[model samples]
Target: MLLTLAKEIGFSHAAAVDPSSLKAQQEVRELCAADRCGHYGRNWSCPPYAGELTAAQKQLARCTEGVLVQTTGNLADEFDIEGIGRLMQLHSRRFATLARQARLLYPKVLPLSAGPCTVCRHCTCPTRPCRFPQKRLSSMEAFGLMVGDVCRAAGLPYSDGSKTMTFTSCILIMQ
Candidate 1:
């Protein structure tokens, strides 16, 4: 039912995953520390503020399973920047809806997004408290998760091997 809802909400794909398969590795955290996306220490959903790696692992241990959701878009060329931006926006909105509904069904739902929280135009992170704490959804990277590894474990392809861009997110459920 949740998977169907995910599709209805506009995700390209959705699948179930075993919680045990999602591991929190220092290597992944190290990558996040690189701050390629530039949200590393700037947003509450990013690392440091996202919580310690141990805390993320502990939360993962409590989850029974998860649902991996993705939104994929074909690029016109190697530099289809506009297309990528559109897909990102669409995926973010869709994932937020899915996460919100999932929380309604299971209060303990943990939503790990593909990127930083987009609830605010500019996060009041390090400067002040998050204006919308209840709406902020942390990224999987923020939780020290390697999105590729999690997708592979879920029997889903992180990328379709096409000239496309894919954004992925997952909702962990405790039962």
Candidate 2:
């Protein structure tokens, strides 16, 4: 049911995933700490502010399963930064909508997106409280879960071997 809804909502791919298989590795968190994306400590949903990876992992482990979703798009070559950004924005929007709908079925549904929460242009972190706590999104990396690993555990292809870009996310339903 969730998978169908995901497809209807415009996700390129959706698959059932076992929460236990989604391990939060220290290496992944370290990458976030590196701050190459310039998102670390800048928001309530990024690293440091997103909380410990162990807590995220434990919470996800308690869930029975989840729906792994992805948005894949052709980027006129790997350097198509504009195309990539557009696809990512599309993915973020779809993810937010999906999460809201998922909450109707499971009030405690946890949404882990492919990147930092962008609901607001500027997040007031390390100072003021999140303006939209209910709408905040925590990235998969912030949770320390490697995207490729999650896709493999979910029996989904992380890459189709094509020159395309794919952003992945998941909504763990703790029912």
Candidate 3:
């Protein structure tokens, strides 16, 4: 039922994961803190702004289960920036929709998305508080959760194969 619901909401793949065994790796957060993605200090959903890695760990500690969702896209080539961007956008949209649905079923659900929150074209961080605090999403890496490790722990494949790119996000559910 859950997997079907996830698919209907637009996720290409979905799986139940053990939240208790998930790890928040410091190295992942370190990469963000280094501003490698160019969104670390520029967005409200990234580190130093999203909240400390420890805080994310504490928040997920209360989650009893997790639903990992993925959207995979095929690129013409590894350097296909347009394809990559389009796929990421699609994944973000689907993840957000799935998060809203999960929130209805599990009120305390925390959604960790594939990238920075794109709910607004321009984030008002540093200048002002988040406009959609309720809908804002933190990236998996920002939360210090390594995508490959989480997927393996969930018995899901992180990569689909060559010429394919997969974006992963998770909804932490209390129930």
Going through the candidates in the order shown, the clash numbers are 0, 0, 0
Which residue pairs in candidate 3 collide?
Answer: none
Could you give candidate 1's per-residue lDDT for residues 1-175 as a string of tens digits?
Answer: 6787787897999999888887888887788889888888899988778888898889999998789999998999768999999999999989989988988888788989988999888998899999988878989888888899989988888997767999999998875
The better candidate by TM-score, 1 or 2, is: 1
Cα RMSDs, all models: 1.1, 1.3, 1.4
**Per-model CA lDDT versus the true structure:** 0.87, 0.87, 0.84
lDDT of 3: 0.84
TM-score per candidate, chains pooled: 0.95, 0.94, 0.94
Question: Candidate 1 has what TM-score?
Answer: 0.95
- RMSD of candidate 3 to the true fold? 1.4
Name model 3 segments beyond 4 Å from true. none
By summed lDDT, the worst window of 10 consecutive residues in model 3 runs over: 1-10
